[model samples]
Target chain A: MSLQRLAIAACLLPGLVACVNSTVDQMVFNTPGAGIGDASVVILGRRHASDYETEPEFIRCVGNHISSRDKSIGVVGEQEFLDALYPWFEPRTAPLRPADLERLLEHRDVARAFTTMQTRYMIWIDGSTVRNDSAGSMTCGIGPGGAGCFGFGTWSNDANYEATIWDFSKRAEVGRISTTASGQSYMPAVVVPIPIIAPVQGTACDSIGDQLLEFLSAEY
Target chain B: MSGSMTIGPDRWLAATLLVFLLAGCGTKQVLVQSEFPPPVMNKLPLTIGVWYDEEFANHEFFDEAAGRAETSWLVNTGQAQVQLWDTLLKGMFRDVVYMNGKPGPGQMNPVVDAVLLPAVDELQYAIPAHTNVKVYEIWMRYRLQLVTTGGAPIADWTMPAYGKTPTAFMQSDEGAVRLAAIVALRDAGAHFASTFTSIPDVAQWLASLPRAGDAARRRVQP
Candidate 1:
């Protein structure tokens, strides 16, 4: 066989059943000082919108990724922060802007608890990943002899997210970061169905985490 | 004689019929329970008392959607309601006293500066029957009335709270509803703590209190 034919055949060996495409876009209005100290950060999902609510697991995924990458910085769980502050940080009462934070800190209890936490940055994430596009279907049947699935099925998911970073210590809006990720998954069956899944939301989380690390950290 | 006996069609028919007959439950009773954290806010420095009536104490909503085969849901918010309000009133006021009966011309009541009454006005729940995602949601409307110690009306306001399960995957219907109700209760606490002074009548009433002169100056604050 020709070299070109062999190369093409090699590419097709894995069936090319799964692929993911993702992008990260960030804007920095101000940078941090030298080196990140023992300050902590909270990655919270915004759920004020009436039509949709940010998935709680997605916020945890991003927090896990950020914390796992750097051991020096402390990452507070979304529920922990919300529960600690109680009604203050709940969806309906959360501060939407840096100025709101200033007002929120006017209260003695809110200011005392918030300032003592050493939370330097508040990252608000808003968005979700949805299976927007899909086509094809698989049919399965069970009989007295055997059961098998036949046909080719494929689907695609789109993920869009935005991160608004607030420097709580400074009471200022530092920057904004957004990510978009799309992935395609495919399933094919001769007698046995070979299913392939795409990591659509995971990709989005990775992009957001990387951008956040760069946006918030002074070193690494 | 043969050791094996032949089975008759009657037995097979009876067994098949038994397999198809399912003992399905017609109703689902969800006794909602949840914990509430103390809110962060400036306390209104007026001695207050709350009275929970029989209907408000055992609040339950029976939801039977129209023209669906779904099981009827009886979500009892009584326990959680008392717990939430008890905690919330404590966080918002300098002192809280739970009274046994309503204040009236003849009824015996506590010597509080004001009395707060909270009742569930309406509750609605929805579950995904045809939607792609399996999510359970609940919305609650509360009628809150503030009255003087003599049962004279100070301010009456309506507040709404909403909550939904993050995801229903791998969760039972009862568990999902429980979580949803908990979330809704928390949402109510948040709303009350943050927006109590935002209501015009409530703010006016708060400002009218002798100890709330400072509150009157900040009544217009967001």
Candidate 2:
């Protein structure tokens, strides 16, 4: 009985080690040069919580995103336009200066989270705009040519995803990333999950993030 | 919101004002600080250049269909896209030094050092110092495109969009087209000094040097 017990213990140890190694690997894999340990990932956008009526699949995908990673990713949306988009989105906009966007990035806490062990990464999704043909705006619904059109009653469509990463310590643009897609009206529009890892020529948000992480991690 | 203030030796001529053209039109302007200058002896020279590290050649625009278009479009039509990108680059070197409470002692507009630095390379500022006092040298080069609907060649009106009457489409704001030019002395002033040292030697410092911002700041103040 004692010999049998020892054999079982030896068999289980490797599996446990593999689990531990896998967790660490995933963390390191997600962020190539992220200063090791847990890094806080903050997703700032107009939408936060999932909406079944409007974006059911998106809502489901967000839940899957949160569960996949051990790090925390919070959403903020205090601006007038942002408040209306997400259910749990917390609205936040820095005191923007008149000089330039570079100056605007200098505002403390705009990108970096100093208190936590993790660093702060911000993603800004552009706000949606209404479509009106008379004033030269995009249409809300379908057109006679089978193209997308927007009427007065419909809400404005969302802007492309433009993610800009900043290092609080450096106080300069460490990484800036943006995303956009085209199709007829909103039908053609699609929002991919964050940390898009495609290595293709186009539609590669993950690759952009990966490259930025690599640069930040590189020893100068 | 539109607002203006009068400033200058000839107060009547000075219509210093700011007006917001449009919101979310992919353009913005902000006040660094509020302070008046003595008088305009000369306008500051704006230095514009694509640093060796920056990817200027393979530059691309935002394709409505492409996901990566936003990154290209923003950088392309960015603040640097305008003629003023050079001006602001030069302006950063002008008045304030790091941690100093006052603007540089010499003329703020036309810094002698900026006028001299561009002479080192063709990619640097090409124009010689202007002879006139009021008119500043506006040396500008920008990437642009003339997009038109498919049509026959017409000396007078080649495109259908250009009917008998001229329209706004004729004056396209296509990707960084005509970035623009302006002659004015702008200073972020002493408040911004804490973040910078002094504008150091422009030519000597290679792009490879680390903490170059610190080096530049140390040399900026006279």
* Colliding residue pairs in candidate 1: none
Q: Per-residue alpha-carbon lDDT of model 1 for A136-172, expressed as tens digits?
A: 8888986657889999988898889999989888888
- Per-prediction TM-score to the true structure, in the order listed: 0.85, 0.22
**Top candidate, metric lDDT:** 1
Write one digit per residue (lDDT tens) for candidate 2, span B36-74: 222111212222122211333222233232332221121
lDDT per residue for candidate 1 within B22-43, as digits (tens), equals 3233567899987888887777
Which model scores highest in TM-score?
A: 1
What lDDT does the true structure give each of the candidates?
0.82, 0.26
Best-performing candidate as measured by DockQ = 1
Q: Relative to the unseen true structure, what is the C-alpha lDDT of residue B19 in candidate 1, on a scale of 0 to 100?
A: 66
Q: Which parts of model 2 have CA positions greater than 4 angstroms off?
A: A1-36, A46-114, A127-159, A185-220, B1-222
